[model samples]
Target: MASGGSKSVASILLALNLVLYLVITVIASWAVNHGVDRSRETASRLPIPARIFPIYFPIGNNMATGFFIIFSLIAGVVGATTSLTGLHNLSQWNAPNLNAAAVSSFTTWALTVLAMGFACKEIELGWTDSNLRTLEIFTIIVTATQMLCTGVIHVGVSEAPSITY
Candidate 1:
């Protein structure tokens, strides 16, 4: 509802989110393309141990894992725009009615996911000893910011596409 009536804000937010997500994805992809990336090499060397979803979610969830989740995060946001939940408040779906449930639920769910994904930090080691954990948290924050920015930018706008971001 926020930026739906105005395209400028929505586009700007989307572009920004995409850029941030791309930075992380590109770095991870490069690491996969080369032997320089540690996760890829480890996964390839010991494929058996990488089957667990959570453990394997980040590095190779699909985009190549160490960064694959970033792509999924993108997909999740983009998908929400087109999902049934998003359409409930759109002019295309409800010519005039604006049920609060859809908006509330969608907003709540989106924010919750973004928060969880953004602030995720499963490991608790000495701050100085957990470089990768720190990096993961950093990525989560970047991804979360992108998602949150994209999702909330148009919350009060009218008739604009409800982006999952």
Candidate 2:
């Protein structure tokens, strides 16, 4: 179990991560809906040959949009679970599960970094729409923040020496 100061710091960081996750999810949902509408409109204008040819099809946009949506959902779920777990640990204040809490934070940070990498690749390819791109940039920023907070939580909780090693 963590001390009072460590628990308080971890709680604040976890709450921040949770809020960022929610924001990222909302922005991603907007981007996905916008992409779908834009894709439909663009598809209607494409020639039959272009539509038939897989190479010419705008599949990259669809794929990126899907990635954004899926990762956003994943981030949200992970954040929620992490926050809930942190709350449970805080309530108990016994500290046996501090390592688990640290592991959870690390996992959240890794996932956020993964999502950011995908988003950056899509941005580099210039496949996303302007609105989607803006939202994605925002998501990236939020993810970065969440990642930082998780790092803090991990550091705060990992100092406990429950392991024999």
Candidate 3:
């Protein structure tokens, strides 16, 4: 089992991951809103006939941008829940019930990585911007920290009790 210091570090990392998740959520939301506002402004400037019967939606970005937006929101919820579970496990750090926390952390890590992939695909499809780039980088960093903390927690907890004859 890991020592107290290791447990504390794991807890701290988990907390930091949560904070970073929130930051990503905020930045992504801002970018989405900014994109929508720009689209609206451009639409308003169009000529009367073009505005009256638009042939296509002016989402501006390609298909991957839509996927990126969807996945990022999903990742935010999963990461938040995982962080809460991790904190709960830390509160009961001495218990031999590490499986749930470890599982949640692993799940969050996977989702975050997936979201990063979506972000990359969106960028590749021409959704490049400072905000999107920052979100992608931060998501990768947070996923790494979450995975490390999950490993530390698994090491720190004692094994589950086995039935005896």
Candidate 4:
């Protein structure tokens, strides 16, 4: 089993990530739905260059916002799943479980980073709605949190005493 402190740290981080990811999921879904609902009206106002794209987001830098939304949604789902697996691993506290959790957490962190890149681009392009801005902030925060969670899990796995049959 891992040290008590490491385990607790991992648990807290996993819980935090779960909540953040869920929020990201909800916000991103809302953004997508909002865009779809207003697509016809939005499309009419868009420039010819923007009209070429299949999925049109009416706010922000259209292309960056669209990519940001898509990636944020993907990262949110994956991060939530990773958090669940991490919770299971915390209960088990064994080599195999830790390894699995570590891998998932790392993957989630990478996805979050990808989403954060889009968020940065969206921010640079400017003209985002409140919801979109919220999603961007959450994505940026999740990226950091996910990295911390991954690091904590990795440290726990390394610090855990080896067991032999």
Most TM-score-accurate candidate: 4
lDDT of 2 by residue, 25-72 (tens): 676666555556656556677778645433221334544556655676
Query: What TM-score does prediction 2 earn?
Result: 0.67
Structural similarity to truth (TM-score) of each candidate: 0.39, 0.67, 0.73, 0.92
How many backbone clashes are present in model 4? 0
Q: Per the 3 Å backbone cut-off, how many clashing residue pairs does candidate 3 have?
A: 0
In candidate 2, the residue pairs with backbone N, CA or C atoms under 3 Å apart (3 or more residues apart, or in different chains) clash, namely 1-95, 1-96
Candidate 4: worst 10 consecutive residues by lDDT?
A: 54-63
- lDDT (10s digit) by residue, model 4, range 1-165: 447889999999999999999999999998888888877887887789777787678766558888889889999999998898899988888777888899999999999999999999988887788889999999999899889989999998887656788
Give candidate 3 misplaced runs (Cα > 4 Å): 35-61, 123-127, 158-165
RMSD of each: 8.7, 4.7, 5.0, 1.8
Q: Enumerate residue pairs that collide in model 4.
A: none
The predicted structure with the larger TM-score, 1 or 3, is 3
Which of the two candidates, 2 or 3, achieves a greater TM-score against the reference? Answer: 3
Worst 10 residues of 1 by lDDT: 121-130
Best-matching candidate per lDDT: 4
RMSD of 1: 8.7
